[model samples]
Target chain A: AQSVAQPEDQVNVAEGNPLTVKCTYSVSGNPYLFWYVQYPNRGLQFLLKYITGDNLVKGSYGFEAEFNKSQTSFHLKKPSALVSDSALYFCAVRDRGWPSNTGKLIFGQGTTLQVKP
Target chain B: DAGVTQSPTHLIKTRGQQVTLRCSPKSGHDTVSWYQQALGQGPQFIFQYYEEEERQRGNFPDRFSGHQFPNYSSELNVNALLLGDSALYLCASSPPTGRDTQYFGPGTRLTVL
Candidate 1:
């Protein structure tokens, strides 16, 4: 079985400051990880993903995340926070062990990123 | 090049009633998946449809069902709804192959009283 966890329920940061939201996962096989952001009453918007290759991956709106194999962590980070970046962030995983091309995504509970201006 | 879209942005229904939610996948996408998001929780997968067939499903019960049309549009039908069924229903779509990166719609807010 595979699962994801966003330990922090909420994280606060000031505009222009760096920010981070932690995420961890468990999978029997190779892991396909992703990060998404959601605005009020809106669906999730794709931010970034880690399939393979480089551990660091960059995505929309200046957001990025690093996939750590040893720690089993994939944390979302931003060099500088913006008020517009404030939203609910989620971490997801796809179990490669299940079957190739199976698009089932297991998501974390979610972390509310509150960026104060 | 439109993204995924869902109809009936907001809905209210009583217990034991049935509700149907609609979804149109992103252009060129052939797979549609349904998810249920309870307040303060992550979205849970319901099922997936491809080529007008039920391709995959999650832990949801039989009461939760769906249909995919030839146009790649889909509908989610919930029977004998319970108050616990009140949640945000999300629709996502992806290409038929490749990495299978899914895109989501704004979602339908269903309130079961």
Candidate 2:
């Protein structure tokens, strides 16, 4: 069973400071990892994805994720955090195989990022 | 240009009542998927519809049902709703090909008393 884990329940960082949200995944085959951000009362916004590409993937809103196969991690990072970046972050893994290619995503327990101004 | 859209932004129903949530896929999108996002948790896949048929489903019960029209619009119906069913219902759309990134719509918040 493929799954994702967000070890941190919450991460607090000061504005303009570098921020990181940790995520690790377990999958049988090659993993398709994704990062999404959710604001209060709003739908999730796609941030970035890693599907057989460069280890460091950049995404919208100045966010990026480093996919490490050896570490089994895809950690989200930003050079400088903004107050608006304070939101819930989710890490998801897609099950890739014959027939199971339903595009179903197994998500991790979200981590709340708090950017203090 | 319109991203995925869901109707009844917020709904309130009793435990035994039934409710229906509607969704319109993004322009040029042909596949629709439904997910449930409970408080403090990530979204869980409920099912996916393509070609007016259910292509995949999650671990939800039969009490949850859905339909996808020819135009790629969809509806999610829940019967005998339980308090545990209260959550944000999100509808996502993606192209038939690639099928990698799914654009999400503003979710419908369902509250069951």
Candidate 3:
């Protein structure tokens, strides 16, 4: 079955410093990778996706992700972080193959991003 | 344009009771998908509705069912709810042209006591 792993439970970054939320995926065929953010008691907000094309995909709130096929990784990155960036981040994957590509997303447990000021 | 929206921001029920959650897709969207988010975990796909039909479903029990209206609104009905059913139910919608990117609603918090 297709799955996503977020390796970290939480990531702490100082304000103005860079931040990285790691994610890895496993799927047959190509992978449709996505990143979402959720504030307290809020729904998942779409950040960005890697369907195809360039290895680096840019997204909302000045965020971006790099899709590495060989490593099967699509890590969310931000050059400089702000305290407002604190929230729960999720990495989701969908296999482009049959039976697995029908709008069903396999998500990682999630990583809590705490941007300390 | 309005994003996806869900009704009854919060709900409390007991075991064996039934609950229905509603969702209004984003403007110009034609597909709606439901997901269950347990505390401290990622959201799990429950099912998806397109053209008022269940186009795809995840590994969930038959006790969970849904319906989609012509206006693109949807509802999730869970019967004989168990304590485990308590979760934050999320609704997502996607445009017909590019259903790849889905936008989610605020979600309804269901607590089974």
Candidate 4:
């Protein structure tokens, strides 16, 4: 079984300050981690993914995430927060090596980020 | 090119009524997936359609069904809807192969009265 956990229900940050949304996962095989953002009444937008290689992966809207294998964590990060960045964030994980199988993403509960000016 | 699109931005139905939601995959994309998102929760996968067939399904009940057309568009049909069925239904599109980054459409908000 594969699953993800985002401990925080909400995160508050001041504008221009660095922000982090924590995510942890449990999977049987190599983990393909992902971050997605969702605004009210809107669908989720892809932020970034960690498949292999570098621990740090940069994504759209000046957001990034660090994948720590030892910790089984993939925490989303931003150098500086923007009011526009305030939204709901989700962490998801999928197992690799099953190429013939359709990928099924297991998602966390979700974390709401509020960037205040 | 237009991104993934879903029809009927909002709909209200009574309990036991059936509803159908539509989705058009992004340009040049061949795969479509459906998800159900409850308030304040992450989107939960309903199923994935590829090559006009249901390739994968989640833990949802059989009352939740779907179809994929030859043109790569898809429809989600939920029969015998319950109050719990009210939520935002989202459609996602991704390439059949390679990176597997799924782009989402603005979801259809369903309200079951």
Question: Which candidate leads in DockQ?
Answer: 1
Residue-level lDDT of model 1, residues B1-113, one tens digit each, is 88999999999999999999999998888888899999999999998887788878999889999999989999999999999999999999987566457899999999999
Shift of residue A27 alpha carbon in model 2, Å:
0.7
Residue B37 miss distance in model 4 (angstroms): 0.5
Q: What DockQ does each listed candidate score? A: 0.69, 0.61, 0.63, 0.65
True contacts kept of each: 0.56, 0.52, 0.65, 0.61
Report the alpha-carbon TM-score of model 1 versus the true structure. 0.97
Whichever of 3 and 4 has more lDDT, that candidate is 3
Greater TM-score among 3 and 4 belongs to 3
Worst 10 residues of 4 chain A by lDDT: A94-103
Scored against the true structure, residue A40 in model 3 reaches a CA lDDT of 99
Could you give the DockQ of candidate 3?
0.63
When just chain B is superposed on the true chain B, each candidate scores a TM-score of 0.96, 0.97, 0.98, 0.97
lDDT score, candidate 2, position A65? 96
lDDT of 3 by residue, A45-82 (tens): 99999999999999999999999999999999999999
> What lDDT does model 2 reach?
0.92
The reply for model 1, stretches above 4 Å from the true place, is A97-99
Give the C-alpha interface root-mean-square deviation per candidate: 1.3, 1.9, 2.2, 1.8
The C-alpha RMSD in Å for every predicted model, in order, reads 1.3, 1.3, 1.5, 1.3
Q: Using alpha carbons, what is the TM-score of model 3?
A: 0.97
